[model samples]
Target: MATLLYGPQHDPIHIEDRALAHLKIVIATKLRRNETFTLSWKHPEAEPGGRSTIWIHPSIPLRFVFDEPEAPQINVRWVEELMHTANSSGGIMLVDEVLDIGEIERQH
Candidate 1:
């Protein structure tokens, strides 16, 4: 299965097809602007409020995998929707959930 890696909030934020597209855009824009930030969210696969982070770099690949056929066709429209929801709900997007901890710190 594809790894999503997103959380620590009321709702779960799995890296589904559309979510990944929005993340690609956000990260691309941030990298284009030479800006870095952190975001977090909860994943349904984990307990409620379980959190994690990822470090986003411009050099990171944004290409979708072969199994993700629908991802190739999705557009920024979904990203826009996701942004609106996240912004209004105070939720984190895909890359937003990525953080650099400097070390493999354990979670409680």
Candidate 2:
């Protein structure tokens, strides 16, 4: 699992390493352009049965930590999907990756 330490409180949001890798790209792109958005996700099974949303801003401190020593192969399609939603008024909604076999094969 990977962890996203966001904002000054540094609340830890656990995500799969591959998913976090993709989210990092989308989040960085938006922040770079000085765009602010919300990230919503369902609480993990270990947590209470509910969902959470956070307002992401450029000024806020954010960090991505991966348990793995190396970063996983990023799925470009997944990033694009995330970027698309990040632009929406509803903001970015965390969803499972729709793996592109062709993309994975190309990466190998």
Candidate 3:
């Protein structure tokens, strides 16, 4: 698992290391251009049944931590889908479903 600490008020969002790595890429790209958007995801079972949303801004303090030392292979299709959501007015809402990290690499 990986942890994404956003600001000081919200609890850390736990995500799989693979997804976090790619999310890091997508998020960094937007923030680099000073684009702000909402990121929503289903809360972990421990957090009950609701979803969580955070306003992602360039000014906020954000941290991404990966459990593994090596980075996961980037899934281009997954990233494109995620970016599409991020670009929408509804913003980026992550589904609990995770893509197979190896699946993309094997094709190339």
Candidate 4:
């Protein structure tokens, strides 16, 4: 699992390393453009066991920490899908990569 630390107080958002790798790309792209988006995800069991959303912006501090030393394989399809959602007014929603990341070698 990987943790996305967005703010100072909120607990880290835990996600699979493969997904986080892809997300890093999507997020960096947006931030590079000075675009802000909301990232929403269902909390892990260790968290509140519900859903959470965080406003992501270029000015805000953020970090991505992976358990593995090296980055995992990134699915281009997943990045496109995530970028699509991030462009929407509703913002980026974390979905199962296996369902959308077609034709890419899944890092499982």
**For each candidate, how many residue pairs have backbone atoms clashing (under 3 Å)?**
8, 0, 0, 0
Model 3 has an lDDT value of: 0.84
lDDT of each residue in 1-108, candidate 2, tens digit only: 889999888879998888888999999999989999999988888888999999999888999999998888777788888889899998998888967878669769
Clashing pairs in 4: none
62 Cα displacement, candidate 2 (Å): 0.8
lDDT string for model 4 (43-108, tens) is: 767766689888898877799999999877676777889999999999999877745443534534
- Report the CA-based lDDT of candidate 2 relative to the real structure: 0.89
Best by TM-score: 2
Query: Tens digits of per-residue lDDT for model 1 on 32-72?
Result: 87655544545656446666555444454434323365655
Candidate 4 lDDT: 0.84
lDDT of 2 at 94: 89
Worst 10 residues of 3 by lDDT: 95-104
Error of 3 at 81 (Å): 0.3
- Which 10-residue span in candidate 4 carries the lowest summed lDDT? 98-107
Candidate 1: where is the Cα deviation over 4 Å? 1-14, 46-49, 59-66, 72-108
Rank order (by lDDT, best first): 2, 4, 3, 1
Worst 10 residues of 1 by lDDT: 4-13
Q: TM-score of model 4 relative to the true fold?
A: 0.84
TM-score, per-candidate, Cα-based: 0.45, 0.89, 0.84, 0.84
lDDT of 3 by residue, 1-108 (tens): 899999977567898898888788889988999999999888777667988788999999999988999998777777877888899999887743345658648768
